[model samples]
Target: MLIAQVTDPHIKAEGRLAYRTVDTAANLARCVNHLLGLKRRPDCVLMTGDLTDFGRVEEYRLLRRLLAPLDVPTYVVPGNHDEREGFRRAFSDHGYLPREGDIRYAIDDYPLRMIALDTTVPGEPGGIMSDERLEWLDAKLRERPDTPTLLFMHHPPIVTGIEHMDVQNCANASAFGDLLERHRQVFQILCGHVHRPIQTLWRGVSVAIAPSASHYVALDLDPNPRREFYLEPPSVYLHYWNEGSLVTHLSFVGSFEGPYPFFDEQGNLID
Candidate 1:
């Protein structure tokens, strides 16, 4: 199965631009088009978080419209920027999402089981793995111990060198890691809040953070780095499950010269 992961579109309403610069809606539209134009279309799309800039109803409405072009099933979790109640209301049609409380659920329709975690704090920029949320995940993992499972959330549990981003990363990461020690079925954790593509191993499980489709957090590793973003080349993460393992590919958005033959018409290597 092929899964397309698009994160942090940060859609704004009334034709507004994110950070007074990036045209998030347009970028997301292009990203959506990119996904549709992929040679091997994904079976589903996982939108990790930050679907809107302010989590307002209008923003969610616009976000829904922007994502309407994607024909494949799409799943989403809330990020710090997303208001829980508004987010739930926006995606009410998605029956997988609960009507109240944390927006967490499990999907078993495909070969790879997926469990979505809600890490958003009500009015904060940081994330947390509270006892309630962790308990829910533990119970879900227990139900299918042998099945290969994928966990999708907004905040990554690992600490990247970017100090600013790290501070707002998922809190109680060690506790979460300890939880993973028991659930061997969880092969991967897909996340998005960092606004940059990152991969690492936590508790023997693979964790991948997909870059934003709108803007990217600048790659700064200083102890007191500036909290800034750039309109980088937008992209999406394509996860392909092949032969018992999942492989992820970073597919950049926008048009570029390509398909040039590397070999001559006679099939000889071009010199």
Candidate 2:
């Protein structure tokens, strides 16, 4: 099975730009088209978080339109920029999304058990995994200890060395990490919110962060305090699972030159 992960689209109001700079809607449109045109389409699209710029109703409406071409199953979580009320209203019909309470839920649709975790703290840039949430997750992991489960959230539990971004990361990450240590069935943790594709090990499990559909966070790991992002080539993570193993690939979006063949009819060197 193949799963496509799209993150941080940050779509805004009609004709509006994100953060007064990036044309996020246009960027997401290109990404959507790329996913649609893929030679091997993804079984489902897992949008980690930050689906809109300000969690506005209008923005969510625009997002739905942008993702309309995709006929596969879709699952989403909320980031700091997303408002729970607005997201629920916008994506109410999404069966996985709960109409009330925390948006933490589970899906057993395919071979891999999926969990959409809500780590967003309302009205705050930083995220927190409350005690209730922690217990909920612990219970879920215990239920199907043998099933390979994938957890999705907005704020990553691990640090990325980007000081500014790290401040807004998951607050109770250490506790969350401890939980992972006990649950060997949790194969991977998927995250967003940094606007870049970052991979790291958290508590002995693999944590993969998907790149944004709009721009990338500047790859600066220095001590000088500053925040930056760039319009580098956009991309998403495509995960393939088979025989109890999962492999991920970075699929770059945007048009490209021909994928010319190299071998001749006789399977010999072309030149």
Candidate 3:
């Protein structure tokens, strides 16, 4: 089984730029086209979040149209940029997103028991997983203790060296980590929000952050007063599950050079 994780398109209504510069919608459309053209389509697309810029109704509507080309099953969770009510309203037919609560749910399809965690706190940039939400997660994990699970959320558990982004990281990370300690079945924790690709050992489990299709957060180590983003190459993660373990590969978006085979006519190396 293979899964693709795309994050943080930050789309705005129609022609508006995401931050008055980046063409987020166009970037997202390109990514969707790339996914559709892949030799092996991802069994599912785990859209981590920031589906819109201001969580506006129009923005979500535009997003649905931009994402219309994706034929694979998609599971979405929210980021700080997303509003719960608006997200629920737009994605109500997903059948898994709750009609009136934090958007948390699980996908039991394929071999992996995929879990989506709601970490976005409506009016804040930082994330907080409430006690009620944590309890729900505990129950879900307990119900399928032996199944290989992949947990998806918008906020990352570890603090990347970027100080500005770290300040807005999950506020209840310690509590969240403590909960994951008991569920060894959780093989991976996939997330978005940093707007860049990152990976680390979090709470004794593997954790990965998919790069945004819009713009990338600059990889600055020093603490800047404001966050900075750049037009770095965007990418998505293709996670392949073989046997019992999962392996993830990063695919840069947009067209590049070529596949150019190196072998000659008789399978000999070409100089």
Of the candidates shown, which would achieve the greatest TM-score relative to the real structure?
Answer: 1
lDDT of 1: 0.93
lDDT tens digits by residue: candidate 2, 80-142: 889999998888889888889888899998989999999998989888887889999999988
The Cα error of candidate 1 at residue 95, in Å, is 1.2
Best candidate, lDDT = 1
Model 1 per-residue lDDT at 113: 97
TM-score of model 1 vs. true structure:
0.99
Taken over the whole model, the C-alpha lDDT of each candidate is 0.93, 0.90, 0.89
Check candidate 2 and list the clashing pairs: none
Q: For every model shown, what is its TM-score relative to the native structure?
A: 0.99, 0.97, 0.97
| Clashes (N, CA, C under 3 Å) per candidate | 0, 0, 0
- Rank the candidate models, highest TM-score first: 1, 3, 2
> What ranges in model 1 sit over 4 Å off?
none
lDDT of 3 at 224: 73
Query: Candidate 3 deviates by what RMSD?
Result: 1.1
lDDT comparison, 2 vs 3, better candidate: 2
